[model samples]
Target chain A: MPPVLQIIDLKDSQATRSYLTKQTLRSWLLTTDHKRVGLLYLYTIIVFFAVAASAAAVMRLNLLTPRGDLVQAETYNKLFTMHGVLMVWFFLIPSIPSVLGNFLLPLMLGARDLAFPKLNLLSWYIFVFGGGIALYALLIGGVDTGWTFYTPYSSTYSNSHVALMAAGVFVAGFSSILTGLNFIVTTHKLRAPGLTWFRLRLFVWSLYATSVILVLATPVLAMTLTLMALERIWKVGVFDPALGGDPLLFQHLFWFYSHPAVYIMILPGMGVVSELIAAFSRKRVFGYTFVAFSSLAIALLGFLVWGHHMFVSSQSVFAGVIFSFLSFLVAIPSAIKVFNWTATLYRGSISLDTPMLYAIGFIGLFTIGGMTGLFLATLAVDVHVHDTYFVIAHFHYIMVGGMVMAFMGGLHFWWPKISGRMYPELLGKMTAIVTFLGFNLTFFPQFILGYLGMPRRYHAYPEQFQVYNVLSTAGASILGLGYVLPLCYLIWSCCYGKPAGNNPWGAKGFEWETTSPPPSENFEKPPVQTEEAYAYPVPSSEPITE
Target chain B: MNARAILYEQFSDLEQQRESSLAGIWAFIASEIMFFGGLFLAFTVYRLNYTQAFNEASQHLNLVLATLNTAVLLTSALTMALAAASNKMGWKYSTLLLLMVTTLLGALFLAIKGIEYIEDWHKGLFPGSAFAWTGSDPGHVQLFFVLYFLMTGFHALHLMIGMGLILVMLLLTWKGWINSRHFMPLDVTSIYWHFVDLVWIFLFPLLYLLGAKI
Candidate 1:
């Protein structure tokens, strides 16, 4: 006998469930089922979305007039800080990956469930427990550390709820780590027979890349936040410059996780877009190898360029120059991905459905987002424009405009399968159009505001910045409308939308090869892959299940 | 059916699963290395900046106690490995004993850690605005203590978790549930226990040896 015992002897969760389901509270609370766990994450993230969106609303109200008419500088500071904290930490990062990824990864991989399902649900509890403490912090008061939680300020200066929020973030880090662990183990051990690595749907590859980042990067963030909490509660001399600690060290620690974190946000959407582009365009993904490896390249190259955020933090000049260079290098694979995606659409049977519209919107916005990133990557320009609205515009272009678009596209695309119901395609397209228009209207003006030298995180602005701020605030209203529309229809669709046929889009992935609204167990028998992912020239007339 | 073929059929799946899991665990451990690796690099850089102070500070670290803890931790790791091995060999009694010993050693390690924290408290090495120390470089001496607390405290947390896991393993072993065939529990616990040991193996020398030139 070999010396090592197998580490994963997960009990059939149904046994645990049947026992728990006998007790109602235990059924819901003690449930270790991945699907139930996903629902918990979905519910919690929705709460986070509401909380963060409210902050955004307040921010827009304050910006209604250029100068601060509603909230004080301190209050304004808290709003923006909370907005960023809730969105990045609570919603955007975990939205698709944690909830949907947890739900789908095992199913798509043809497994019994994730390698560690209890860990999956435990991750959700950690997230919500963390969110509770953070919400309590907001209720009592708030932290002024900014979402970045920049040190010394977070440790010494801010009083609202730094410890509580940092503790929340610290706790949430475990969730990310567990999710990543579950995904990594699942992808490694759980594939159906004949489902090789290259045969993986691009979405699977995206989640795989995302899971890697989650495992590798999140622990650093956890430690950073732990150190911050210690400093706040105990007055530790770790980041406090009064005691000879370097504030710059904290920046290094925080950004190391947060930057790669942005990839965690986008990689899944990139996965979604890949499926979207392929299905709608009726093509095998052009340059499939390049596109897949490009995802991996982006995840890897992502770690090298975190220093770009610190150029103006007075890091060594040589370091700044090097970061600028490496930042440019990171863009190459991202550019290659975009090119490959656009190439996939060249002269195919293109369908401009709701999901496809969002995908196209993603291409345009992400291109702008990405190109502006290049502008920021140059030392000379970045030094001039660091912490300006240009930076704001640059990220919003990618984050809200690109990732959120792709997320919505994926949601619309998969809603049929997930709910066994199809949404009104017309309404989804209208929402897509309004979102794009509002998004551009909101952020496009901010680029000029940045160029004209308006700083971010300020409650009031000078007369010159007024016009842009007003336009931006107006755009937020429309953007808010766009967001609410989907919540309405998606919920409606769950109950009343028409029953979707299997292979509704005639897409060829293992996921769609299964039934719409797949059984409690994912498959009757493992799916056999006789062809490549997104295989073309398989007549559109043929069913995806064939 | 003969026991050998039954075992053979079971062994192949277990072996493949083990190889894949070990690869995954090693990958995870490498990331952990990079995680703590960043902190160690920071400690190195800061120590380089204040070698004399760091040297003086190292004298205050209880080397004998640290040495004792290291031995205890490494032994726990050995027990953890034995538990995994014996599980695979169908040595049920041996698996439970190894698990119990591993858990016991983990408790001893934490007890030593508590004593060390008490000693540091007596020495005024705890970090705070009011903290005071008599090392050559006050600034970096405090810096040294910051690292000391962070690294050791983080290590203690890991030990606590390893202890919890061993307890869980002991429970499963008690139920006569764990065995050679379905031993994922042993493997996972071993990975975690070894990780905690590996962290200390690095920490002991960093905190107690290098930079001690005073």
Candidate 2:
């Protein structure tokens, strides 16, 4: 046998004694083990993703015709609301952080587990409980207040399950806060010996930045939702303009958290892409400090740009100009990340693996999403496309295109380590191609629709926009297929795929130092980091062998 | 080996574990500050926008009861601190006693707060459309009462959670699970208790004292 297969067999035997194979279902449920908790988050988030994607499917089908044909106008409203709520809170926000972050942080940092392991378990329970309540609300008659829950309609007019949904979100916000707190403390206090701040991987840096946003911004969301719930339940005028409450006050409080929330969704993806770029390109990341600091810069600058979302909400032009300027400034850090990743790949031994494909896709799509954002930030352009499909297209590009692509890339890249098996490479690459193509086909036309003066959130539309709607629907089906492929193949790989030894991709990180599906305590002993992260070889066609 | 020396299989030593636990609590407190910070920001904006109405509405609060509740919470913080200090000193009996005192004081604050809520309800200070505030700008005044009830209600919920945590600590102390070196549960709980107290300190001044001189 070859040396790699010999190593694979040796590690495979050890992996059978992993946290997963040794535990019963009851033990798994009650586990304080970070790996088990990470799996728990993974399974739960997939369920939420299915629900949200189904909602998206229905919305796409409904939009297929110029006249609304599939669902009633009210049902369509609830459909989009459910899609927004489930996707934003249940899926995207926690996607990489809870699942990959929980699993990898300790492994990457060489810690045994997170700082507060029990708190880690509790955060999962809190998330499930909150998601349960929200799901229950959806079953009982859904909330139609658009996930934004903008005032007067949410507080006074709408007679749906606004309070229940808000309560669910309010409770879920705590889960985010606790998770953030755990990550922050672990990153600060639990690094292995000799693992100084600058020696950390960029993924760890991005997790740290994401955690800062999670810790600080999520609480504001909790408070804002609490007030919204109170207003809905008590018939108070906190947001009702007719009752002398300022509607703008609600907008200010909501966006203050929501804008930072976009970063909470994408920062982890950026971190994942950094890992993918370094490993596949077989080079140390170019301008490591710039990329690391850009994560922090994004987190800090994210807070100031919330005003950009409120540009047309009766906000002063002066405030709009300031917000527009800050919004443009926030894009610089994101641009820095894109540039750094490209520079890292320049003339390097680049491998077009599945994960690298996704990373490259993320760069292109995020650039487009981010640049269109500048258009929205421009005072006059925003006035034109304020509530149009352009806004819808812009966010989907960032969220679905940028973040989701990176999420898939990270998941595929880390799957061997996570599940102790190598997924089929050809299948993985095919799915990546399908996802990118389908995602673009689905959203790219919305830009044209918006530019042609088609507004969003309407159940019915004029006949002129039918071609774009049809194309978007067609793309949705393909995207849906693309997403389903991984769900099926990944599960199959988990059970039957070839065993993946440690460091299948020959990544130069501490996490790759351990066996695939590392034991419950992670490393057999504490690992002391002695080298800079991503210390890949210069122009090596093959990964270095021990 | 001592039962408490399990070290949780994660940390290298007891000291590292204890420090990590303390850091976790402090990080949680930092999040709590932002949680309450949002409400405070809203209050500041509304207060500036509707100064006279807020002050006039604030005057309707039962000052004596709120002030008494403030003292109760402050006393609870003291007892909580004493409990943690005693645990660190290996004084088991004194730790238990201080913990009980802290829990009782927290409960006392809640009791007073409940009475004040009932009084406000009777005085028609609720924020419904038919609220009976016969003052200038009833709408903005209603806004004040809305904020008052919301902030205080959330604070009470937090106190209840704190009380529950104290009860857990009490049980653990009685069972001998927590002692001098194993006092992390109590220590972290005390940090949380003090956070509850700190939130009240701000709420007292913002909600009760804003209208005093006006």
Candidate 3:
């Protein structure tokens, strides 16, 4: 038996106690437990997701007709802006990191909690406070500057609550900073005795890389937004071209942070898919060192490519060429990751599990998303497609198709460990299939619409584009159902699902060695790793049953 | 000292706890560098674009008060270092005395900064649309003042946070919550104080000294 099996005999009452039960409301409100904190983030982001999705639903409903039909132009503007702000800052950025990273970083490292658990709780409070202010801004009179808050319009013209919205995002940026700080310190100092750096799991590696970006990039966003808020409040000429300030300067500063902020949104999803691919393939990740290094490469190269977002914003031609080339260079690492994941499944025993389905879907969709990104990187092509549905469709493919799929896959993969219950596998697989189909249906048409010269962010469009918009609306409804189904079933499984024993999928990692729904301090005694990560046995022709 | 060391459940022992605390603060300082780094980047970009305007704007600053404030902040950093050293030696009374001096010096710097701000307001050098300055490239000069006030304002906020942290450390030290062996709190706070000072070190040259000779 493994050293982990030896600790199975050391289990006591504490080992069986679930983190969810037997905790007072006040205890949960003030808890410093990382697991509880992760749950807190989980519950909170889901609510934000619902609000943003409803805004999306309203937009899709209004877009059904070529003429303005559903709501006024102003309301439509606010809808998209509200969707972008809430989705980007409140949902997608924090989705995986605060939820899965918070819950699993300590467990995977064989540590009891993050390096500073109290700071972890404080990070959550900060997120809520920031989110609260943003939500209040939305409720009173929404800002229509879009999420980018591009200057001139945001600073001088827009009459909405720009300051409140900026303040909300500014304060929320620190929560991300604090969480990243916690993970960096935890990963550096809290590993088990025998767990060497190379022995670390891919998920942990990805989280570490994500943390680096979060630490470095978020503060830039904070500062940029601060400048934006100040400019709006004081009518400063910092970004106002009328007052000798260059608007391109605003674009430079904004994309300097916002572009890397995209990676911040997706890198954790890449990490989650890494874990899912390995577990389902019953093999170690092929080219582990190359795959691990690719993450850092993406993070570092991610910083250089922010200039690409400014290609059409009056940026100089030579600068555009340099940024375009750097953008292509960043794509190399993402391709490296995709190819490595495919090689890991070669001749290996691949299980068509729910998580594996989502992982495979992520590979296909992200490739399409990433390839379209290359087209956008080309200066000539981007000038044609900039500010069109093409840009919208391209990012949605990456953010929604790529990141959201991986998030679902990971949540399902780890749900048993998290909730100590089995969420009917057939239902899980169905959810994955529906989401993949619905996602493609929703975004694939937007590409065609964009190519045919349909501009984005407008309340209405020409009559010829009505069919594609109708198709998109149809796909969005299906996608909304796809999302709602999982949310319902996952919550149901928390209470009514069958009990999940330790190592339900027989996955190889320090996390699975502990009991499902791990105790308050993560482990009864700290686990010491005795073998390499993903040390599954070689495949036999006869399928092995659980 | 060994028996008195307070170890959290996450760490295996007090030594590991101390190492983690130090690493955590260093990571935080790295992020802080990036936070201030953004403003510096903006300053460099605008300075390169509008060189004469930035220099003329720099001439308007109260260099005497800024220079004095810089010295005061540097002296506080010295006292902060001495306090950490005293805490390491378990010299509680000396640590308290050094901390008090550091806090007083920090307050003095803020006082000097307040006087400078009042002087600027009287001169109508603030970034609003008010009419007072008769200088070349008034628009770009306003840009310079915007950056000057924003950078210094944030620095003052960080100093206030440092003061709060020092007060907490002082309370903890007096209540026997921290000792020589368990002085990681003091160590981390001093590192943070030094970082605040280091940002001003960069700020002093960039804001006050950069366009002085020009």
Candidate 4:
């Protein structure tokens, strides 16, 4: 009766098994399986994380003395630049979405895989190729321009590898775009029967929002960087002031992508925390619709406030005022997420498990980060502390304290599902706590030093700022330990830790309904989602069964 | 239809597979729009700042050749549409013929564009040190040519990619891989081709015709 006959190959999937069983390098290198691709991203980004963190470590240690002891001024500039570029593009942007989203999206949606599985694999290849090019730039001679790649200096004067690094980011930008495209199409066309928009998990909602931002915003960065690279190579007047070009134009175009890029960095972490909150608290998210729409709202409103970053760049006063107001408005959606997450936690079965501990850390630190963001959004206040350490401290809180916390928590929460083994629960909890303390120690003093007018991007500072810098350096060592422990034990758990069954935490989601590692086609049969996501506190009389 | 013949493992049925491909291509198109949108924004700002110089630069572009190329490209779109329609009707030979015709038309457009580029190069319309503009506001005029080359160069790159894809589709069609029962790849390729065509449609009026009368 249908126009075209449709057939379901039931027998083919009857033999479905673990995707990880194929243990050849070639299988992984050429595989289109989403789960394997997810692992590929996981392994790749971890390498990037270590490199970027090491750069941060060296910089923090160098800041310990007022005399800029560790590296030259030029070298320090390159260190921070490399740190920001590698971490933002290589690690944070791809962390949750590429690894966890690639793994869980299909499982949650009850689809076999993403809409374009080959595109997913291709994105990973492009990511690695681009990352290789970028790291190669660092190995040869590094670009001194910060990740912002502001013009005139970068376009006309900088002697370092600006064009090469821009080329790397440009290539990687396509990877981000493709990944976003895959997620958006998968969410749209691949949902299982009975899974409506409102019925999807909060994590999926957040990724969808993140994907929209990725799809729309990243290409502008690609084009902007292309122009920047071209200008550098050709010595054109595009961003060079000497040839009658305006530098502000570069800032405008850069922030247009970069500001939304800030959201691209954080929204998935918010998604992960939403899942952590619901799983730990044993309750439905209090305002599910509000939380869902707020993700979309953040993605949309993020575009309008890019001008906030251009406030002190000699933009018009009226434009600054508009950008300032728009920047404040983003807090509405962000606060909605924080408040809704907290409300979901209130009076519930609160367990301070490792994932939940990281989730709690996310809430506190993100609140601090978000609140400080308001201070920077205030026009006069920003003028006073524009490029100061306070600004550095503010973003580090959001990026490191907030997003990194959420990333760790999500990794812990999904560890059982991801690896089919439990990470040592006690060790996990301790790392989460240490990371929290170390993060505060590391960044909290910078807020004070910033308010005291010590600028960023400087290797040396006044003696009054030395005490805080020392504390921050001490904290960096501890934080490094916190990061390293999980890397060691998570690998150990994969081989030797007790085998975790499908639903370790009694987590309520379609992903939990399958085998621990999940089959190549995700589910044995297409799952029909009948209840809404986070249908928590199911009566104890009826147990959840695999 | 052989159930396993055309369907990918990830999809349950043919309809879902086709729908997914359609949705995926449209999403890619939306991204491409934003990609070009940035270049267009640059053009708008600079044109607003240096109107007379931009007008002077615009005059240097070979309008007759560009107009001929536009016609050639628009005809290629028509032939591309016919190829898709012929494949749908299961007319194998006409599909192949129309595809070849479309590819040729696209080649002709590129040829005209190449000729124009050569003409511009002879005139020293290139943006760097060899630029030979003696007009007032030479700096901004040089800026105009810089954008002119970047925008058109990027467009040509995309068009080349489109042609490569179509060539592959042509091969696939000859091998009976993209027949009526499984034409999603060809359909999506046409979508991309049209998107590139559509971008040129906008680029034509904005770049080549800006202040032509004034």
DockQ winner among the candidates? 3
As for TM-score, the candidate ahead, 1 or 2, is: 2
Q: Which parts of model 3 are misplaced by more than 4 Å?
A: A1-16, A540-546, B1-3, B129-131
Please give each candidate's TM-score: 0.92, 0.95, 0.97, 0.96
Docking class of 4: medium
Query: Per-residue lDDT tens digits of candidate 2, residues B12-66?
Result: 8888888888988888888888888888898998899999999989999999999
What TM-score does each prediction get for chain A alone? Answer: 0.93, 0.97, 0.96, 0.96
Model 3 over residues B15-45: C-alpha lDDT tens digits? 8899999999998998898888878988999
Candidate 2: DockQ?
A: 0.78
Q: How close is candidate 4 to the true structure, as a TM-score?
A: 0.96
lDDT of 1 by residue, A467-520 (tens): 888899899999989999999999998767876755789877766765566655
Clashing pairs in 4: A390-A450
Model 3, span A291-328: residue lDDT tens:
88898899899889888888778888999999999999
Better of 1 and 2 by DockQ: 2
**Model 4: runs farther than 4 Å from truth?**
A1-16, A538-546, B1-5
- State in Å the error of residue B144, model 3: 1.2
lDDT digits (tens) for residues A313-424 of candidate 4: 9999999999999999999999999999989887778888999999999999999999999999999999999999999999999999989999999999998888778999
Tell me, what's the RMSD of every candidate? 6.6, 3.2, 2.9, 5.0
DockQ for the candidates, in order: 0.37, 0.78, 0.82, 0.78
Cα lDDT tens digits, model 2, A462-541, are 99999999999999999998899999999999888888887899889888887787877788678898889887767745
